[model samples]
Target: MTTLHNAEAGDRDRKAFDDPAARGQLIRWFVSAAAISVPQAAGPVTFSLLALVLTGDTSGGAALILAMTVAQVLGAIPITRLGRNRSATWFLQGLIAIRTIALLLMAVLAAYGAPFLWLFLLTAVAGSVHGAAWGYLRSVLNGLTPASKMPRALGISATLNEVTFVLAPVAASGLGSLSPIFAVVAMAVLGAIPALLVPHVSVAPIEDTPHAGGSVLSPSILLWLMCSAAGGSAIAAIEIGAVALAIGFGYPPALAILFTVPLCLASVAGGIWVSVRNRAATRGMVVGLLCVMTGGAWLAAMQHSLALTIVGAVLIGAVLAPLATYYSLILDILAPPNKRPEVFALLRTANAIGIIFASAVLTATSLSVALLVVASTMLVVTLIVGAVSFKEKRRA
Candidate 1:
C-alpha cells in the first residue's frame, strides 16, 4: 500500500511539473520580455540618427552609444546584485518601470530640443538599468522553466527576440520618417507593456546555494563568452555599416532596409528550427556554424553585387539565432545556478564590448575593411575555441 501511494505521489508531481497552465504563463512572460526588447533593439539606429539630426555629425551618435554601452557594462553587476534576493516578478517590474520612465523622459527632451549632452546622459541612464532588466528576465525564465524544457523555452524566447530585432528598427525607421521624437515616444509607450504583465507570472523559488557550479571565469564559460563576443561584433559590423554598404554598391542608402529584412527573416526561421529540435548544440556544431558564419561574412564583404550581398546576408542570418540559442544553453551548463543573472549580465557586457570594438573599427576604416576585420576576428576566436574544446575532450 505504501509503495502504491509513493508511485501515485510521484505521478502527481510529474503532472504538476508538466502542467499546461504553467507553460502558458511562461510563454506569456517570454512574450512580455521580448516586447521590452523591441525598443532596446531599435535603440542604436534611433540614437545614431537622433545624434546626426541634433549635431549634424556622426561622432555625436557614436559618443552617445559609447556612453550607453559603458554604463551598461559598469552597472550590470551592481544592479543584478541589488535584485538578487527580491522576487523575480517584482524585480523585473521595477526594472521595466525604470526603463519606461527613462525612455519617456528621453522623448520629452527630444521633443523639446534638449542638448546633446543631456541626451547622452539620459541614454546612459536608460542603458544602465536596461542591462539588469535583461539579466532579470533571463533569471525569471530560468526559475520558471524545468531543466528538461530549458532548451525549447530558450529557443522560443530567442525566436521571439529575433522577431523584435526584425521589426523594431523597421518600425523606428518608419516612425522616424515623420519625426524622430515620435519614434522615441512610441518606444516609451511600448516599454511599459511588460511592466503591466509581470504581476501575472509565477516563478519557482531558487534555493540560494553555494555549491552551484564553476566560476564565470572558468574555461568553458570564457570560451562561450568569447564566441558570443565574436558573433556580436560580426552582427554589429553588418548593422552599423548596412547603409554605407548599400551606397558602396551603387544603391540608395534607404535600400539598407533590404539587407536587414532578409537577414532577420532567416534568423526567425533558424530560431524556429532550434525550438523544434529542442536540443543543446555540441562543440563540433558550434565550430562548424562559426565557420559558416565567417564564410558568409567574407562573401558579403568581397562581393559587390546586390544579389550576392542578399545571399550572404541570408547565410549569416540563417546561423545567428541558432548560435545564440546554443550559447544560452551552454551558459546554462557552465554558470552556477545562483549566479545565472549576473552571468547572463556578463554575457551582455561581452556583447556590448564587441559592439564597441566594431564601432571603433568602423570609425577608423572603410566599411569593407571593417567587415574584413570583423570576419577575421570571428575566425580567430572560433578556431581557438575549437582547439580548446578538442583538448578538453581529449583530456576527458
Candidate 2:
C-alpha cells in the first residue's frame, strides 16, 4: 500500500510540473505577438514602395503613416474601454478581424489602382484598432504569466517581435517587387493567424476595482509614457527614412532591408540576453540606454556612410529590447490591477503620437533633419528621466 501511494504521488507531481495549459498559453501568446507584428514590420517598406509607385513621391508614405497614427491615438482609449468587460481572447479576435478586413480592402483598392486618398482612408480605419489590440495583448499576457515570470515572457515576446521586424521587410520587398498589393494582402493574412489561435489560448478576465492612486496622470506613469513617445519617434524616423537613406548612399531601394535587418537582429540579441539573465532594470540603467540611443541617432545623422549607419543601428538596436523590458516592468509595478489595459493603451497612444510627429516632420523637412529631431527628443527625455530618478533617489 505504501509503494502504490508513492507511485501515485510521483505521477501527480510530474503532472503538476508540466501543466499543458501553461505551456500552451505561452506558445500561443508568442505566436500571437509575432502575428500581430507582421503588418507593422511590413508597413514601413511596403507603404513606402506603394507611395512611390502610386504618387511618385515618398511624402505620400509619410502622410499615410501620419493618418494611421492619428487614428490610433484617437481610438485607443475608447476601443480599450470596450474590451474591459469582455473576454480578452474574443476581443482580440474581433479587433484582428477588423484589421484584416481593412487590409483586404486596401489590397483590393491597390490592385484596382484606386486613388491615394481612398487608400489613406483605409489605412486609418485599419490603424484605429492597433493600439487597442496591443493593449489587449498586454493584458492577456498579464493574465497568462505570473508576475515573477513576466519579465522573461515579455523578453521572449519582444525577441519574437524583433524577428518579425527582421523578416517582414525582406518578405515585403521581395513580394512587392511583383506587386505591392500582393504584399499587403499577404501580411493581412499572416496577421490573422494569431486570432485563429485565440480559441486555444485561455486568458483570465481582469476584474475592475477602484483604487485611489490608479489615475493615469501619476508622475511615474507619465514619465514612462513620455519615454515611450520619444523612443517611438526615434524608431519611426529610422524606419520611415530608411529607403531615402539607402538611396542617398547610392544603394538601390531594394537594398533598404540592409538598414533595418541588422538593427532588428541586434534587438533580438538584447531581448534574449534580458530573458536569460532574468534581472530587472533600474531607472538609471534606462536613462543610460536612452543616452546611448541618442548618441547613435546623432552619429547616424552626422555621417552619410553605410558603415556609420550600421554602427548607429547597432547602438540603437542594442538598447531597444532592454528599454522596452524596463518600460513594461515599470508599468507592471506602478499600474493598478484594474487599469493595466487602459494604461497600456495610453502608452500606445503616446507612441502613436510620436510616430505622427516624426512622420509629419519627415514630410515637411529632410530625412537628416528628422533624424536630428529624433536625437534631440531622446536627449531631452533622457535628461528629464535622469532628473526624476535622481530626485526619487535623494528622497529615499
State which candidate has the highest lDDT.
Answer: 2
**Candidate 2 ranges with C-alpha deviation above 4 Å:** 1-18, 48-62, 112-116, 199-212, 243-258, 304-309
Across residues 201-231, which tens digit of lDDT does each residue of candidate 1 receive?
4444232213347676787788878888888
Query: Clashes per prediction?
Result: 0, 0
Candidate 2's TM-score reads 0.86
Predicted structure with the largest TM-score when compared to the true one: 1
lDDT of 1: 0.77
What is the per-residue lDDT of model 2 for residues 27-112, given as tens digits with 9 covering 90 to 100? Answer: 88888888887877788768888888888886787677677778889989888889888877788889999989998999888877
RMSD of each: 3.6, 5.3
Q: Estimate each model's TM-score.
A: 0.88, 0.86
